[model samples]
Target: MTAKVTLSFTDETIEDARRYAERDGMSLSAWIDQAAREKALRELFNAHADVVRRAGHDRLEKHALDDAREVEMVRSEFRGRRAAQR
Candidate 1:
């Protein structure tokens, strides 16, 4: 599903986004949407990392990526279970 939204951006920001969209071979809307999605995913990942760290399972250098992946997988399963119940 796609939505048409009205958003306001400054001239400089618009120009920068246009340049990036052209460089990436995407429409302006698509570029903006992709950027927004990436930012959201980054925040979600960071939130998960904070939870893991607070739980005293913060990653060691050798397995940092693996630990993050495991956390993500576990979180995904938990989300799935909740969805099923609802």
Candidate 2:
């Protein structure tokens, strides 16, 4: 079930969205709906992630700062390896 809502956009933003819709071979309304849905989904996921992190903070044993740095180092190393292989 869907309810219709009216939204107002600045002229420039509207024009940009219309151009993007044309480029993607979609109607302006369809493109806007798709973008809106994706943004809403992302926000919902982020909210859920925050809630989960808060709930498990004490149960999680790893140090947050060290874990983040390690993850970044691993990601950088992996990227370098991949680039070298490529």
Candidate 3:
């Protein structure tokens, strides 16, 4: 289902969009619709990520952090061993 809505744009912008639509072989409405849908989906995913980040750190987050710490420790140990061998 779809509905038609009127929108206003500057003459220059309208011309630009019209040319873009033509180059892509689509109607102006279709071009705008695709752009709007892509932007909407991106915003929706970012919002979901924000909610997850705010929901409180849990076991999964802690485990990832712990893994990173272990990796750093191993790298530091290797550096120390290399320095000793030099």
Query: How do the residues 1-86 of candidate 1 rate in per-residue lDDT, one tens digit apiece?
Result: 67888999999999999999888777788778767866776788688677778888764533765667866875685565435433
Q: How close is candidate 2 to the true structure, as a TM-score?
A: 0.59
Separately for all candidates shown, the number of backbone clashes (residues 3 or more apart, or on different chains) is 0, 0, 0
Give lDDT tens digits, candidate 2, residues 24-54.
7777876787677657756865675577588
Clash-forming residue pairs, model 2: none
Q: Which is better, 1 or 3, measured by lDDT?
A: 1
**Which candidate gets the maximum TM-score versus the true structure?**
1
* Candidate 3 lDDT by residue in tens digits, 13-86: 88998998788777788777766765775686467556656886554555644577755765675555435433
Segments in model 2 whose C-alpha atoms lie over 4 Å from true places: 1-4, 57-86
Most accurate candidate by lDDT: 1
- Candidate order, lDDT descending: 1, 2, 3
Each prediction's TM-score versus the true structure = 0.71, 0.59, 0.56
| Model 3 poorest ten-residue lDDT run | 77-86
- Estimate candidate 2's alpha-carbon lDDT, on a 0 to 1 scale: 0.69
